[model samples]
Target: MPDYSLLARQLKALLDTRDWLTNSAQTSAFLMQEIPDLNWAGFYLQRSSEQLTLGPFQGKPACNPIPFSKGVCGAAARTRQTQRIDDVHAVADHIACDSASESELVVPILDTNGALWGVLDLDSPRKARFSEADQAGIEALVEIFCQASDLD
Candidate 1:
């Protein structure tokens, strides 16, 4: 079991630095290495007009751009909440960028004023990869992203 509290704290510290982009990139790399049984760990950012463009990510090449209502990342951004799918195959609108991925966790990153900004997306090659505890942990990390100073 990953120590989510420590992970969240580490993420918060990383997000607090002046270089957010560099930090976010590093964070993605760190998560990709730290988290277990994960095929992907990265971010998708929404910059203008509700468009979610691919950001720093670590894994197999993912879909270039995802709509706000399309995949798990899109749904999380559209709903401004977390989306955890045990089986990607069972998800009606699941986007299979990596056919090996069996599970996914999407955490929406909010701005300071509680507005949708982007999402932290993680995909696992193993089934039932994310649990409620994982959700809670990642949500804490996203909350840190919301309150952190580095988002632009």
Candidate 2:
């Protein structure tokens, strides 16, 4: 397990600007660089109530406009909860943006007003790449991101 505490501090320091767009891009790059086994790291912003448009990301081209009713990202947006799937192939509604991805983690990004701002998504090529500890750690990192950015 990576030391999340150290990562948190590093992220806090890395976020020198409060701009959401820049921060989101930096955050995505930071996650991809710091985390192991990750093929994709990015954000899906909630432009409409029922859909998420692609945001800053690192990796291959990704699917755009994920609805709130489909896929793991959709599930997280609809439920306002983190969705950690051990195997994407097992999901009946999994969206195969990257055929090489075997596991995924999506954390709902809620603004301070409790409104859905977006979601932070991470994908790995290894099956069961994300553990519960990883979920908690990433969630904590997302929290830091929320606090540091101007998501309103």
TM-score of every prediction relative to native: 0.90, 0.99
Clashes of 2: 0
lDDT of each: 0.83, 0.97
Candidate 2 C-alpha lDDT tens digits along 1-152: 78999999999999989899999999999999999999999999999879999999999999999999999999999999999999999999999999999999999999989999999999999999999999999999999999999999
On the 0 to 100 scale, the lDDT of residue 64 in model 1 is 65
- The TM-score between candidate 2 and the true structure equals 0.99
Off by over 4 Å in 1: 13-16
lDDT of model number 1:
0.83
Best by lDDT: 2
Model 2: how far residue 105 lies from native, Å: 0.5
Would you list the clashing residue pairs of candidate 2? none
Model 1 pairs in collision = none
- Candidate 2 displacement at residue 104 in angstroms: 0.4
Evaluate model 2: give its lDDT. 0.97
